[model samples]
Target: MVLSMPSPYKHPSTGVYWLKQRVPARLLAVAKGKSVTVTVDGMPCTVKLGDYIKVSLRTKTIAEAKQRANEAEAEFNRIWLSFENGPVKLTLKQITALAGEMYHAISAALEDDPGEAALWAQRRRERAEVGAKLKVSPAAALMIRPPSLEARLGSWVDGALKQHHLTVTPETYQRLLVEFDRAVGDVATLLERRSRGDYSPDAVAQRFPPVEIEQRVAAPKAAKAVGGDDPTTLTGLLAHKQRTQSKKDDTFDKYRGCLKNFIAFVGHEEVGRITKDDVRRWRDALIKRGLAKKTINDQYLTSLKVALNHGVKEFDLPTNVAANIRDERDAPAPTGSKGYSAEQAKTILQATFRGSSKNLEIPYQRALFWVPWICAYTGLRVTEVTQFRGRHLREENGIPYLLITPDDGSTKGKNAWTTGIHAHLIELGLLDMFRAIGDGPAFYTPYPEGTDLKSLSNHRAKSAGDKIADWVTDELGIAAPGDRPSHAWRHAFTTLSRTYKMDKEARDYMLGSRSQTDAREGYGDWSPEVVDAEINKLPRFDVEASDWRPSLELVPPRPLKSDLPPRRPLRVRKLRAKSA
Candidate 1:
């Protein structure tokens, strides 16, 4: 016997035919239901009725079902066409008459078939039972779509705050939003799993619990003046301080580490409850860990004090318990020396050319070659040099310069400044390196977008600096009484600037250091040309490292109009003279 092809209206799961049709966009909202399912000889079949009607002839025999289904479909189309052409609109009286007719027709149908009414009531009970199991009330189930987790949490928080008549600071408000979003996300994940039958309600509650809001009792005016049960912990205070303050990445990391250590030691206690003894004990513990007294004072003590002081001011606490605690006065200075000498700088640069101690990867080798040279010429901090991008390099009035700004990342004082690129660096192919790196960061390998952690970038750059330092110390056997190999270049730059009699304002501007005088010397409209002139005054290094040059040959891209700011004339101030 030959096999027959299946009909297009059949549903594979039920082995029964269905009549499917699309609902018109205009009638979808008012349509009673999309489709209805019926059983044909114990097999479920679907009849789809949109604004227009469609019917399926449900039968086991294929030949009989196809013939009957075509006849039913033709009859439905005829009735739908007649209804469509009959009337587009009706008067208010006519609408009332139609509503009466519908009500009477429904009542007659229920009165005529007691079994149909009973079956309908039974389904209603079953649906109510299922809704109860899902924790959805009958009224809630009537909603078109349930409110999202974020919306629900936001409304709850707003209601809680209003009920308590509480006002929170911007920092506190932001923290609450972050916490609520996290909680909502957790609850939402569990709800999704529960809906998909992957989790039971009890399992969901056990794994991801609901958020609880703490109750606040109404307090007297005097009690309110002193922060009453504010629930702000030491950790919260420290986080708020870091968010509000402008600090470099390295400095911020140190603060975070110090605060974390204090929290671990002292426990996450209330900020107002921490006493001076607690701070002193923490300091003593650091000292017992073999940390130098100076380290305890400078790193641990300073960070703790700042956090407590911030808490005192922000939370209106009675006192800063860590304020009166003093650092060890007789603590010895650090063992190793700081800053490099001229001779040491020469030896380091030469060793970089020779690849003296050990080999490095290409990216690291490139950083090793240029970072020291840039520091040697400009006295920039290692981070400052490493964070450079192609856009930071520009030409103003025919002179090339590096715009040491926080546009890309943090700066020393969180202030923007510009300095000229030394001529020797240009001769050593600095421009070529910028061209090779293109539009993003200039040094080290480019991280994939968001993965560029500031602390990690600084650490890697510092590691590269250390590698150069190690090469100078081990291979060249160069040592100074109080010198750091990479930082020695900065000292060397300062020395050369002073030796050549470069202007104090220009030198300070290049170094990004503050001037001694009360008057803001370089803040007013100083032209890049003047800064470039002072930077050019520094004498070039006369080294014999012939193979130390960068081999990059790409042409530098032209600077955009936004990169090169318009030049303004320097503001000159008149001096007052006194006569005796």
Candidate 2:
């Protein structure tokens, strides 16, 4: 039997000691939640820590409980202090003083005979650029992106933050960037001075006040003092939901992230103890963070409400506390369907024939040229378009169809079925492109190993889609907050199909939208010829992109994600604390 435990609270019936403490008041709101390393079955499991900390002493004796209690309490205080809003705000002069120190170190380092040839070559190029800018506008020279920025960026800033107990803001960071440029530029100017054989007294270096450094007091590590309680946490519910249900992996990831943030803001894991007030505080905090009201309501708030609603049924939650909490759109919903106009659609399609301005990879450049055309003709989500494999292209009774499903990558819905390949896409030599790529993902590869966010849900398809979207926005200059460039294709497809009087059921099938009224909708499959007929009726984009068609080897054999490096869950969890 265990001799001791934290004696703050005791199980009266079982006569076991426990430690129960209210979460510190200051950390009741947060921008995001962090993983707290916890232990279960002697294995380390990370949990979204909640509002109160309750630990079982696992000992019955008073003296032993007190000793454990002391240790637990000490560690708790240390972690709480770390999370609390840190150090007094740095004054403008003090901030300048910190930047001044960076100037001295950089100038002095370049003063002597430098080490490596490559380093000198790189630095010499950076130094030359600074020298040219200094000649034009010495004041503007420091405003250039800091060349010697990284050398002392961490040590100088970290030392000052710790010394004065300061937190840097974006505004302060902008100032520091200018100050660092000044430091590096001054070094460049000094080097030029030395080369000219005039060893003059350095005026700029003498102006900076020294950044004071102080000895730091190390605190007890959280893993050493931290312990876990086996209770239903908000994120734990999401895990259980994922295991039990058939839902989109991406959606689950989003919900998991939202609930973790909520739990962290409230400060604990005990679901029964959660209050509506706690959730309100979190929502209010999100609002203060200047998140768009739509984002706050749809993504953040809605996610919590959905998770808790499930927790009510599956995990025996008392009630869905966040059920009705929502941020009503602060402004009226913007009127207008998010679809490209005929002219805009043609422009976007025509531009695909031209080379990408961004240095896109071969596969991605192919996606840039083809995805919009495919999206224009087929109305497929950007992901569905990118997931194309040669085998996915099949002939049904002399009509070709592309398969849309989760077998390749994450798709939005369960409407996994054949979609007729528009004749327009075929006309653009899509078939040849598909054949050249072979039986492999046409647009993306398995994310390389050691990717920080490599997961079943956060796959490379999204990355491919994002690359296409960025090009459409930046190169095409089609950026609007209400309308997404990639997604607007869906709206345009629906509109054109309606205008052409294509069968609603065929249109719905192509879009993967579920038919709520008719149960027969899911029973039978659409003939590729029939769908192809309706697809042709919708009409093709009048613009030509034949020149943009791929001539290079488009895709290699399909990448095996299973062969890639295993997922490394914790870059941070591995930091000093693995398991307590």
Candidate 3:
């Protein structure tokens, strides 16, 4: 059998094949040569409106080029037909693709022309309207739709059942079904809107709030009434809070501890029976225990007040007994003017490079050596530095940056930002360590694998920070009485940046501390080059010791397998008798 091949002429200069076709009459004047550009041309309105599509063949081989050209031509013809048919009615799939293309085009244009901002906003509004009309979710309208409601719900149910070995009664099962039905109803509503040409998922969601299924159990015959002496205890309020509010395990645990302590002090009386005098006594007792004023207010009193306030609002208690009790204690004095001094920073860096006196493991040593430098340069919180993964190192416009994000774990205030890596850090071989780790976390080893608990990572990172702090304070003797070694570097960065007179916005951008008060900051127009320049302005720490720099020759630890004696040589039984 004979195979047909595409005939393409090779370009003289580039030695690349070129597929030539006749130019359409409408685009003849615009065409530079005899061959037409393989793009939309017959649709004058599309071309005039700058909405025509152009796809690069992206192949040097004639066969591939020709195949791509044919595909492009088919797509162009489809678009041309749509134009000829008057106002085009697009499919959900086509609309999704167009929305993505439009978004990219608008984004590219916005870089060169700030005036495109208004146009981008207008396009977004139009897309949202169209999405609503099409009954698509906001995510679907944006072209990255999630799984179907039924599929997602089924997977979630199966996973929950398998993982927890959950066994539900008929009432509980019905409640679960009700919740699932609400989710299905949301998706159905969006689909219905698409049929009716109401595409704004946000508008639909706003108009119809999500349904919450309440699971109620019949009260026992001997159960106490609201008017009873033990109406709603602190324990009951805590339980109610857990049911209604979403919180991290660590946060809930802290709240529980504080409430438990308060309950112990005041006795587990009904919330209404608790008085301001009781709250005062608890506060005085905490003060007597030598707790810091801030700790007393934040960890103890604040927690108790929150539960009491919830009781007041939810259960119709007489009043929030702890509401009026305020911590009037004076704020603590500054620890050596907030940040570490230059000499102290150098000493800390040297000690970290020297490793812990307690003979810590290599991973812990690396954490001590690198985390402070990162915090010093980036002004990131200690926990943020601890959560650094190899993949977080990203580049834009030839400038490398650390992508500090909450996706790995909790960030302070849940703010996500990027910090330009200083040249000095690279000189100290931080990138080498990053490359060595390669997609795993950089500092803390034994990262919480296959877990969604942010608290685990946070705790591990905090522990690493504490190790560094211990080295600085106990071994180096650099930190002041009130100064924490891990946090001091952040303050040190601020000091250095201020001394160098860096741009305030750039400083804030690097530190992930930008004020949301300015509406214009939402545009996020700060370029990587500008931020990099600001980061470069901060002075590097001066270390006299040559060994202070972290060693670049680092690699991830390999898993240890138990050594077994070589398998005993297997004795082969003679098969000659069988063969004979």
Candidate 4:
């Protein structure tokens, strides 16, 4: 029981004290379809509720109220017609106010700061104007390949912007500029694709420079030699190893650093003159300088082996100098393993499936998360998965699978082993993704001709896997496991298969690795259907495929400048009020 406050003025008709109306009399009476005796300053004002009630009913007589309502509605119609006719004049101040309001709505839609909307709009407007004047879109400046340039490259740029929270660095800007030119050069090719009714930007970008793994550094002397040396000379044993391993130039740089450090420690002795003892000393020095034993060993052995092998292959040295140097067996093996646990992996997958809001932020992060997840669950190597073509996917006996064949001139190593489709791949929703990418070899990395995107994808995948592993470790408040890579997913699959007590032969077949045999082929007894069945038998990840849908405007707004009315000075009071 609450006490009621006394009113200063009493209702004219009602003998009881009444408070002021809580809502607009016409709104409450007319909109709600209820008739109520509303108190206007404690006066009993009877108003009809519902749409039929006029706002002027309280002040005007019945006849006058009806007439006024008709006039007001007519005035509204005139204003609307003027707007449609482009004669609804607005001042600069009015346009700015409307723009501010529009920015707020757009910012809300994008879930970003409203303040940034003005900046984005201004930049977009400027870009449009520039493009119109130049008769080219910013994309036209990019030198992307045909279909690939349009499809994969454009999407990659958008995803990079969103996921990495990245901006173009001077180096990146230069690269983009180079790609822009390459893409532009492909205009003729793009036009052909368009003629065939396939002018998609992603397709153009992807098609622009096809992958060529045979690119070689200049080395005239040792053309038949496996490897070469000469730190300053790009070719040598280091070059051979890079080509054999299908590794990127950066990998060569790592070799250069590690090799230079070792050679400097061992002095400038000729290749055959450097003994196994010197190799051990350099290895120890690398270990002393805080290098991982694995890294130190890899670098030391590769460089030394290159020099020794180069001597044997090119300079006719009797024996490899560092052939007898044994690796330290007890160097305290690497302990900091890195990878997501089952639960952590599941959590990350869930976050990705929920989808990210629009921003130049989380959407890209989701892509990074998604790519690795797809790799892990599918048992595909990072390179194989990233360089996958759409044509690789096929269905047989009512089951979908990925048939991995090396693209034309794109085979790795000497043997062109055609791997059967893994039925488990369908569970990852890659089938649909492949379908969306259209016909052709779908690439993980869209590289120019003569550029090995495989190497770049490998390096990027490794780094991205590390970052995700670090994030997982941090989130779980646990130390990282061994610096496991996306390849570890393949390892994990094999390990899991073994743990589940699968047959040794079956496990080998399922993993697509060769079993020990004189035939040097995959287990002969395994049929394609059997291999497919075994792959399908594996546990499926409870993850949804990412929705890479196009964002279409529900209601396209008229261009602000084009929609503007004739310039007019608004009333002084209205302008001042607007400022306030």
Candidate 5:
């Protein structure tokens, strides 16, 4: 007769249960709040109540938790089993292929596979040797996790207990790997491709965390103060020095670019160790790289100069390294002078008239041409040209004259002076220039408040001036002058004025020169009538004279020599007669 368990219970797998074992005496004898054990007659086994209940509830024999644990156990067991399974009994080709697959799996796990796949190939050879030495099939010699003895004895059990049905085909093995990977955790689609072995180690490494190189090339010894704690980096030092030196930002930027390229070439480590030879070699390379010799040389020189200067001021490196390093004829020389000759000035004026034939608002090209030309002809610097105003044009006793009142901050003194405008400028139809701009003193360009009487020392004005010069040279085939630029016009004016035998006082006044005499308030006392007479003599391009007049009165004529003014008592008198 079969002993049986009578119970109300739940199955772990199905959540339903049926009685299948005996309820031993010990289970019946179980006391309240205490576990008991019972023996089943005929079975000769004592079953504890807790064990019986557990057995009864888990009717299907495996709990869900147990199933998961079993799966994990089976997985680790499988990996170990692979080691034991004495290499699959197969042809050399088959074993060789499987060995390669296993190595790939190992590498994927380790993430350090070499490029040649040599590790996998080696495993295949080792396994083959083991099989030969054993003389039995390599499959038997190879260790393996064995099937259950009871399951092996019963073919039915053998088939039923199999946990996996994976066939080791190359594709199937790869799929098993991908599934195993995914089973652990879902991978990104990109990473999934790598899981499929469709990617290279580089491709995979790129997908995952990359090998970051923490080490970089050392930088040049920086120009920090000799005993400073800041680790010297060339770039940091240069930038610091740039701010410290009050160098123009653009100039600093240029120096920075050259330095960066040079440092990059020599590498950070060798930056401070650089020799003159290294620089020469680098310079040669720049030439070979198609850089103009002058451009390369200029860059090199600027960078070197900045670096040496920084060293002197900050790092206290050996005296200036750039002092003697000079570029030869291969390098372009500095710009000499920039101004238009008389012929070139005329061409520029003509171009201005042409370009401004239609528009009036901008008139930039026209202004560019005419403004500088006026300066050139009048011997005014570009700054003074910008400072000219409507009030400056006045008539003295029927002759057109220009009153040059220097601004409080003008390079010339704040004192005012009067100069005759050449009749030729009036004749040349330039009177309209004065008329177009109001008597209110201001630059042709709209500037912010307080810029009245301001000049062209600014970058924008200089750039515009350069472009105008280039246009005159290129478009009109003008022969431009060297050196002085708008300033040179003053020189020309002084030269021409002297050639024309214009009075020294009149020439100085016309050129806006500072007065030489302390006696005449420095604006030497020239009579308006005489100045007027001098101006009337000048030639012009036929501009009609306007009824403008000077507000200031003329200097009184010197007293006649015989009817001279009374003199004050002299400080030094003949020694008084000692007697009385």
Candidate 6:
């Protein structure tokens, strides 16, 4: 059966109607960082809107809900178009002709009474003033702040939409705004001419070609439209899986967000109605909105495929419509080396020597100072460096190394691995720093052992990574368009390792990377003594920033565990995966 959902969906259970749409990817960063005021439950409140704008229609009646939803969609389309930087698509001839319609109508209607000519003259002056302030064209000023012609424009825009027999494409909408204002001025001039005892066809409007409606093509061979109930829906699937799957909170959050965005993109909850073309078009929309290709592929597209494939298996659907929907990888690849230039690297490490404006806990402040240096020398991933505890920093056979394992928490790889600490790090009082850390986290506050340990470890590691990345970009000014600030050290390490001709397997072990092609590499031990020899091949960084200071005495001593508040008991969650 075809789904009988309201265009603005009326909830089957709660009877509330809603309009949910994803924010365009171009505006996502802005949306995330800015607060917006929205009306809620009859009261106004300021809130940060995320990826999707999910709002109640504020009416349960089907007809009213549908009307309001269309208006909301239209209004948001205009707002989104305003944010876009793409060029206006309509040709000059078509725009002038469209404006010509407005001119003729205004001229004929005002045959008996033309509003004072001075009123429109003042309107023209106001347009010039607004245009100057905004540093925009006169027509753009008209769109931004229409000079007293909004009431007259209401019917004309509606007529255009009806005449086109479709909603305005963003490009058309942008073009129309410019022409709309020009038309207003043109009509005022016609009225002025009529008042002066002269009535003649407008020479400028006469030259315009006929305004034509842009035709939109429909997708070919869309899937069979199907009804939606509870089981086949993404929200339903998420609830059922959460009961069984052992997923991290961050993973769950990511999937949940993807589901909401996918649903909004498709404009429905009926997963069975989803088509390859539907997913393809949605992918194109995301591309238009300027999402990064890797992000679109890895997070949005991958999660959507997972949801649909899961739905087909669990609900016995006909197929995974998006199963073969591939990536949008046609965009030009970014140019430049992934690693920072040597001078850029030196500048980054040097900036770390500059202290923070506000006081931070000793471990955290030092994390800013040392995370980059540790990554530079050890080739440790940012999370791996930030997540370490004093115990993880241990000496084996009088040689110091870092042990990354699931035993400490989660690792990028499932296995336990060790990489040797460089002699340079040891000479800089790394051992003394660990002595001060004393079994607690080196960069973040440590929770009592075994109490939410996994989550705490993950959270702190992510927090520390973000903190360092922000410090590098914001404070140190190491930002380039495509540079990964936190991950740059890893790239720099790889480049240096290549220059030194370090053994491939040894370098891979230091980077916590595994060999997928080689078989013999599986049998080796990268113990401290083994990797330390390879570690020495990489040269020391000779950074001489004026603010540089290397001292373990600067770090505050770790607080006594005895003085800490009483520990909370560990809360265990039971997870059982459903058998295939």
Top of the candidates by TM-score: 2
**Model 5 Cα lDDT, one tens digit per residue, 1-580:** 1122233345556765433333334333432132222112111121233323223222333454343322232222222222222212223333233333333444456443233334434544554464355455442333221232123222321121122211132322322222223222222332344444546533222112211111122343544543332324556666667656654455666776677666544434223565675466456546545666667667866686667666667765665655566455454565643434445445554555454332322434434545654665566556555556566777756666666665412435444667655555665455666675555433334333355332323423344455554455445444456423445556655655555676776666656675566546353377767765654443332223343321111122222234567879644323211000
Q: Per-residue lDDT for 271-306 in model 2, tens only?
A: 677778667767876775567888899999888877
Worst 10 residues of 6 by lDDT: 571-580
| TM-scores, one per candidate | 0.50, 0.61, 0.53, 0.45, 0.35, 0.57
Q: Find the number of clashing residue pairs for candidate 4.
A: 53
Steric overlap count per candidate:
1, 6, 9, 53, 22, 0
**Weakest lDDT window of 10 consecutive positions for candidate 1:** 211-220
Assess candidate 1 and give its lDDT: 0.55
Q: Any residue pairs clashing in model 2, and if so which?
A: 5-57, 50-267, 50-268, 50-269, 51-267, 51-268
lDDT of 1 by residue, 134-205 (tens): 366553332221244225344544432332223333333333333444333334343334334443433222
Residues 1-580, model 3: lDDT tens digits = 0012245556677766544333334433433221112331222111221222333355567777665544444333333322222222223333233223323333334333234334435544554564464465554333332344334444443332222223333223323333443433443434444444444533323222222111111121332544332237665676567667776556667886787666545434457667686688678767766778988998888888888887778777778878878779888675356787777777777665676767775667788889878887888888888877788888887788888887667776666788888998888888878887677765555433454426452355566777877677667656443456677777878888889998888888777787879977767566678878889998877865454644434444432122335667644432211000
lDDT of 1 at 324: 68
Ten-residue region with minimum lDDT total, candidate 4: 571-580
RMSD, candidate 6, Å: 18.5
- Residue-level lDDT for 366 in candidate 3: 80
Instruction: List model 6 lDDT by residue over 187-290, tens digit each.
Output: 66667666665666555454344664333221223333232225556666565555556666567678867766666545455666777866876676567556
Regions more than 4 Å wrong, model 1? 1-232, 244-250, 265-273, 285-295, 328-337, 356-359, 448-484, 516-519, 548-580
Quantify all predictions' global Cα lDDT against the true fold: 0.55, 0.64, 0.57, 0.43, 0.44, 0.64
The local distance difference test score of model 2 is 0.64
RMSD of each: 30.9, 15.8, 34.9, 30.7, 38.4, 18.5
Which stretches in model 5 have alpha-carbon errors above 4 Å? 1-274, 278-303, 328-342, 350-366, 378-423, 426-444, 450-459, 479-580
Write candidate 4's Cα lDDT for 187-228 as tens digits.
333333444455244332322222111111112243444434
Cα-based lDDT at residue 123, candidate 4 = 46
Q: Residue 354 of candidate 2: its Cα lDDT?
A: 85
